[model samples]
Target: MNKDEQLKAAINQKLIETGERERLKELLRAKLIECGWKDQLKAHCKEDFKHKNTLYMDKIMWTIMQFK
Candidate 1:
């Protein structure tokens, strides 16, 4: 693998071994909920579903990134 990929793998391995990844995920979830980002994302998803009658993850994320 390239140097960048190798560095990413090493960092990910350290995070996993130390359980920091899960902790960071939990913290991010809590922060999103606290800031109403979770609710906003849910509303956006529901609105998109209503208009399209189908939910596509890639489309949803793209729209969300634009919205942000």
Candidate 2:
């Protein structure tokens, strides 16, 4: 892996081992909700999907996973 990728992997592993990953996720979720970004994103996504005839569940899930 490249240096940046290796550093990211190490940091992620450390976070996971220390149980900080879940805590960070919770904090991020709370911050997004507090800032109304979560609701705005949901509304924007819903609006985009409303115009589409085919909604791919996997693609939608992948997009959501990117946020997580």
Candidate 3:
């Protein structure tokens, strides 16, 4: 897979392995909020968390903004 795909897979793996799923989810929620993607992230997560594709757009957008 491509770099983006790889990264998403990694995040998915981490989220799965994380014992505190709710905490990690909360952390991610906060980060997304701090990164200005809270609304989109929340709406996307409300649908399903396993569907990484749903959050890819917002994740990528947040990443770009965070590093810029």
Candidate 2: what lDDT? 0.86
TM-score of each: 0.80, 0.69, 0.30
Two-way lDDT contest, 1 vs 2, winner? 1
lDDT (Cα, tens digit) per residue for candidate 1, span 1-68: 99999999999999999999999999999999999998998887777668686667898788888665
Off by over 4 Å in 3: 1-19, 39-68
Per-residue alpha-carbon lDDT of model 2 for 1-68, expressed as tens digits? 99999999999999999999999999999998999989887876786678779879997786666653
- The 0-to-1 C-alpha lDDT of every candidate, in the order given, reads 0.88, 0.86, 0.69
If ranked by TM-score, best first, what sequence of candidates would result?
A: 1, 2, 3
Candidate 1 — which residues are off by over 4 angstroms? 56-58
Regarding TM-score, does 1 or 3 come out ahead?
1
Best by TM-score: 1
Ranking the candidates on lDDT from highest down gives 1, 2, 3
TM-score preference between candidates 2 and 3, better one = 2
